[model samples]
Target: MRVVFLGLAVPNMNEYHNMFTELVVEFRNNGHDIMVVAPTYDEKVFGMQVEDGIPTLRVPTLELFGVGKIQKGLATLLLPYQYKRALKKSKIDLNFDLVMMPTPPITLVNVASWLKRKYGSKMYLILRDIFPQNALDLGMMNPKGLAYTYFRKKEKEMYFASDYIGCMSPGNIDYVIRHNPEQNANKLHLLPNWAWLQPNLGQQEIIKIKDQYGLLDKFIVVFGGNIGKPQKMENIVALAKSCTTNKDIFFLIIGGGNEKEYLDRMILREDLSNVRVKDFLSREEFFKVLQIADVGLISLSENFTIPNIPSKSLVYFNARVPILASVDLNTDFGTHLEAIGAGLWAEAGKTKKLKEKLMYLYNNPEKRKKMGENGYQYFKNNLLASMAYENIISRVTNT
Candidate 1:
């Protein structure tokens, strides 16, 4: 099978740790020819490159990350055209059996439709982010405005264009079906986020990394990945403020995003000495930190009406760390955690309940150990790249 993957951003083939990259590697390992088509704002990095035995076409695109909503919206609106133009100019063959893409820039619908028409390709949507609705959830977009209407239309087009829609969870499948009655129910299927599982870091290496970061002798509650609007970072700040008197409990925030300044300001304004914020770390560095950390923290905004199963949870699962989540009511992530005995969760704005769950994990070392072990076992059994690969291949081939 020859597959072409289109995404907003894709790392070089050498960096194959993320969900999409891992999935791509699985296809290649199974003797399928795969190519990546992604956008790059850096002119120096634009054009095609064969990285570590994979052909990747980096089409020049406007800056999308770390920009204001207006600018970001414009960039997203232009992405499909940019992709189409680049693919037309490139010498790489467009005759692919499958065309795969992840949502975010839903405008990619046009390009996917074009490819399907031109080459008779099967279009598969890896639904990671549900846009327009998510923006409305965060109060970032006016529901009645033109921008919302435009993206909502694009979202529908993307869904209708897809041959199969892979949702992150059961709640997502339900939401999509209930809201978008035009979509075929049989087309929606579960495709949870996955990672390439790696072995845990040795104790000495973990200790060295902890000491280097001045995180030694602390009950570290680490929140990694994007610190964006959907994260509801204030809840984490409130928790840190409440735990200020407890010298043993420390908060470590890793990753950068639009709301990073807000988090920094709140920490300083509240005189929080127990919290530390660090920029994004490499995969290797983050894994070491996860290994040494006592708990993994997940925070989602209370305003969300759509269920979001954060991909970061896979990192915690792979690292064998217990999770303490404060998420929106719509998300079934909390239920999944409790079912597997891998973590605890409370509604996003319920500070008291969140504190209780956090403290329960903090006070019970044996329980934490058991939960971490359970999570790692579950990841091995259900959430590996190979499992996701088989799921996708079997569906595509059978169809």
Candidate 2:
């Protein structure tokens, strides 16, 4: 079988996980031909398509919005057309059996819908993030306006266009069916956001990496992902400030975001030595360090319940590191962590509680290590990327 995986996510590989490569590997291993169509804002991304020996063809890029809502909106409004142009650019001399699309820019569904209609492909919606509803929930977009209505309508179309759909979690299922009740529930599958960090690197090996990086002396609490507004990181920053006296504790933030510069400035103004900021590292470097890091710092804005699950926590598990998740309690994310003993505080994401939780892990290595052990077991049972491969094969093959 030939698979046409459509999404703009691959070339910007730093922004995505190893799921593309993992699936690519599994498909090729099973003797299926894989073709990926990834769009970009630049010519090409290096180091893509290196895994699985699967070939990829990149499409067109989007224009950068210097900085404004209107300019960004215009860029988004034009994306369905851009996706169509990219679709036309793909050199698929051979036909495809399945159309796999990811989201964030939900308009990718239009391309999938087009492929299914014109070429008779089976469309599979691999939902990574849910959409303008996420933005609106986070207070980024007005919920009661024409803009909201337009996005809500498009969101429904994306949901409806998929012949079968897979999501990162049941929380996502709740969101989808709540909005698009007409979609067949049996067609929906919980395709968990997968963790790809192979764990043969044991505690001794990971400890050596930490020692080499001079990170062994500190109780490292690492937050490694997009440092943006939805992070609601002012509270996180304030907690970092509060931990200034705890010289043995360190805060490592690794990722770029719209608000990263502001986060950097806050660190500078506050003269935070315990807190260090680094641009996102390569997967190997990032996970190697995480494997030794004492704790994972997972967070979501209290209001952002729909579109995000912040797949980063899976890394902490794969690395056998405990987590400190700061999401709303009502959400499944918090509940999942609580159920698995991955470590979370009941108090709201207040500065006091944040600092308190950090200190708890910092002072109690034994307890932290136990939480990490629990996480490793949880990852083995649930979040491995290979599980996703089997699930996809089963769904596409209808086995």
lDDT of 2 by residue, 49-144 (tens): 433355665545555333566766776677767756655654345357887877767767777788778889888888877778778877778888
lDDT of 1: 0.90
Per-prediction TM-score: 0.98, 0.88
What overall lDDT goes with each candidate model? 0.90, 0.74
What is candidate 1's CA lDDT for residue 129?
A: 85
The total of clashing pairs for model 1 equals 0
Model 2 misses residue 327 by how many Å?
0.8
lDDT of 1 by residue, 1-399 (tens): 999988886777676457788888899899999988898877788778787677888888878999988788889888889889989889778999999999877888899899999999999999988888999999998999999998899899888899998899999999999999988889899999888888898889889988998888899999999998899999999988888778899999999999999999999999999999999999878887888889999999999999999989988998989999999999999999999999999999899889999999999999999999999999999999999999899889888
Best by the TM-score measure: 1
Assess candidate 1 and give its TM-score to the true structure.
0.98
The Cα error of candidate 2 at residue 29, in Å, is 2.0
Residue 314 of model 2 has an lDDT of 79
CA error at residue 203 for candidate 2, angstroms: 5.3
